[model samples]
Target chain A: MEERIEISILLDFYGELLTDKQKNIMKMYYNEDLSLAEIAELNNISRQAIHDLIKRCYKQLLAYEEKLNLMKKSFEQKKIKNEILEELHKLNHQSEAVIDEQRIKKIEQLVKTAM
Target chain B: MEERIEISILLDFYGELLTDKQKNIMKMYYNEDLSLAEIAELNNISRQAIHDLIKRCYKQLLAYEEKLNLMKKSFEQKKIKNEILEELHKLNHQSEAVIDEQRIKKIEQLVKTAM
Candidate 1:
């Protein structure tokens, strides 16, 4: 995966555990695509401090992932989603199927529960 | 929920993030059903300090739950499991069903992923 995308996901999964300052800096760097110097200027801090803070934030997020593994479970959930769709596709093509909307809604609930 | 049971669940969810000492103390208190005085004597701490540590550990665990909500999500997954089983029950009773072994395997996978 791309670096920024991976970081963004870590932030999404563990962002609530972070301090607000860490979150703001992470969004500016990853989401807004700001330069380290620009983020430093915006926050009235030294560029080196911004760089270190970004590293510290990423480290903290990665540590949380290590303990909880919600991100990895999420990927597993994605695989399950695909498998469900594949089964549905098989049902559609292989027979005169009546996969009811209610079941579909329940399957959707299963997928939604992953996040 | 019962107090000890709830704390045990919290420890299960966030225990990995705690120190080894914290985990040991929590297991002794909750899992082993040890009293505060007994735990303190075992660990060579004052009863009051043991009491404080238990409260601190719970606060920390609850704070983690507040941020991550993995415990709540686990309960939701459990609810989903029941719904899936109920649907399966309905299907089993409503017809001479030909639910394939492969599909049952996949459903089993869904339930196992919650853990």
Candidate 2:
């Protein structure tokens, strides 16, 4: 599960850097949860070839992350967003009548926009 | 000024994909405000070669932005952050007695973290 999450995060940040074939294979194997044999059959390649391609894609994604740190920055942004939301929630509770409705709505908008 | 801003945004998003030489040339030309002749002399290359390298780097940066839209997303995030800050300021004004101190600090923290 942790590995899947990590791959999804990397794919989100660097998938465009990959070739179309590598992107498709990664989406199938990781996002669609397809087995290597299934992807190999679908793409008319050997299972071992599919395995190697996936490994190469993983290495490329990791290399991009290491160099750019986009995934790390994105995760930090998310953490800050959550912290802001929590603070907003506290403010909402402090003054429910005066600050809840519009402030909460704006906070929701900010969260959605950030995401 | 607008062109410089655009290039800076593009550089922030895709500069990591460039070669070290390309990166150095771009930084000297755009960020450091160096002339082509100056850069060429400093690097022991022809002025025409420096110009060509700068153009190639610009093309690669644009291609990356076209493929990934990371720069666009980043701008949108900044706009959202501004909107959130404005909303927080409004909230702060509405309830200075109750919400100003901690909420303002938290909002400042969020803005800095997001940046």
Candidate 3:
């Protein structure tokens, strides 16, 4: 489960760096949870070839992440954003009487739009 | 100025999609503001070839944007995030008496970390 999440995040950052064929194969294998034999039959390739291709794609994705660090930066940014949102929520709940309601609503709207 | 900003945003989204040579050429032309002849001399290529390569890279970057819209989405998200931050700053100032000071500081910290 953890590995799947990691791959999905990597794919989000570097999927466009892959060829069309590799992209489709990765989508099938990772997103659709298709087995190697199924992907092979769908693409009219040998099972071993499908396996190799998936392995190559995974390696490439990891290599791209290593060099670019986009995924790492994105994850850190998301964590911070979530933390800010949590603080806002707490403020809204605790200071409902004293805080301006309209301003709180506007902040909520902006956060929702950003999400 | 606007064109340079657009190119930089597009490059951020799709630069890794380019080959190493193409990426270097693009950085020289767009980011470094190098003329075609200057880039050509730096890379040991003809001036016309350098121009053509930069054009090709621009086209590819735009094509990637058209297909993916990652840069557009990113820009919109940033705008919304900025709006939220503005609202938070306003809240911090206006509600200084009622709102929890620590929470405001925490939100500011998170936003700064995210940025």
Candidate 4:
């Protein structure tokens, strides 16, 4: 339970910031729970460099998560966007007059592009 | 102009993820353009440690930035929020029928809280 909880929080925190390579490495090591040597062999990096990069990346990633607070801020932004979208959807349904479908579409475009 | 251009880019990039301490150091060094020894004396850290920390921090910050693309993503998110807010503002004003002032207010609250 504790492990699951920790992992969820960490994934929620640093998941977005991870490079594809880093993410793959983390998935292998943490999720698939592969050993460092095995991961290094698979990735074709020296085991020592893998160890150093992973350790350093992990530390920096945690620090970035802490300093950036991206996850919390991003979650809040999404919640707001969803709420506004919901309200707008209701409004679009209510009006007998033509909703500015173009404008609404543009707004949706903006939201989608950003997210 | 070139100098300004670079600072703007760098600040826009790493401006959010830096520690308050790191931010201060950066501002002092880059903006005020102080030497490391001056910064060290002011912050009361050893020159060597300051040098090491700053060098390491700069590398890590640049890597975090390159890998995460935080600046680009965050700017896009803000632009979307602003567009949505503009659209919502237009709606609030256009409605002759009872605008859900409370709902609008709540949405505004959400945007304000997030941004």
Best by lDDT: 1
TM-score of chain B of each: 0.79, 0.77, 0.76, 0.50
TM-score of decoy 2: 0.78
Query: What fraction of the true interface does each of the listed models get right, in terms of native contacts kept?
Result: 0.24, 0.12, 0.22, 0.24
Better of 2 and 3 by lDDT: 2
Cα lDDT tens digits, model 2, B39-107, are: 999999999999999888888888888888887877766775776667565664674344455555566
What TM-score against the true fold does each predicted structure earn? 0.80, 0.78, 0.71, 0.52
Cα distance off (Å), candidate 2, residue B113:
16
lDDT of 3: 0.75
Off by over 4 Å in 4: A1-23, A31-60, A94-115, B1-22, B30-61, B93-115
Judging by lDDT, tell me the better candidate of 1 and 4.
Answer: 1
Best by TM-score: 1
Predicted structure with the largest DockQ when compared to the true one: 3
- Model 4 — TM-score against the truth? 0.52
How well does model 4 score by local distance difference test?
0.64
Model 1 residue runs over 4 Å out of place are A96-115, B96-115
What DockQ score does model 2 reach against the true complex? 0.21
Candidate 4 C-alpha lDDT tens digits along B34-65: 89899999999998988887676667666765
DockQ of each: 0.22, 0.21, 0.24, 0.18
Q: In model 1, how large is the Cα lDDT of residue A94?
A: 46
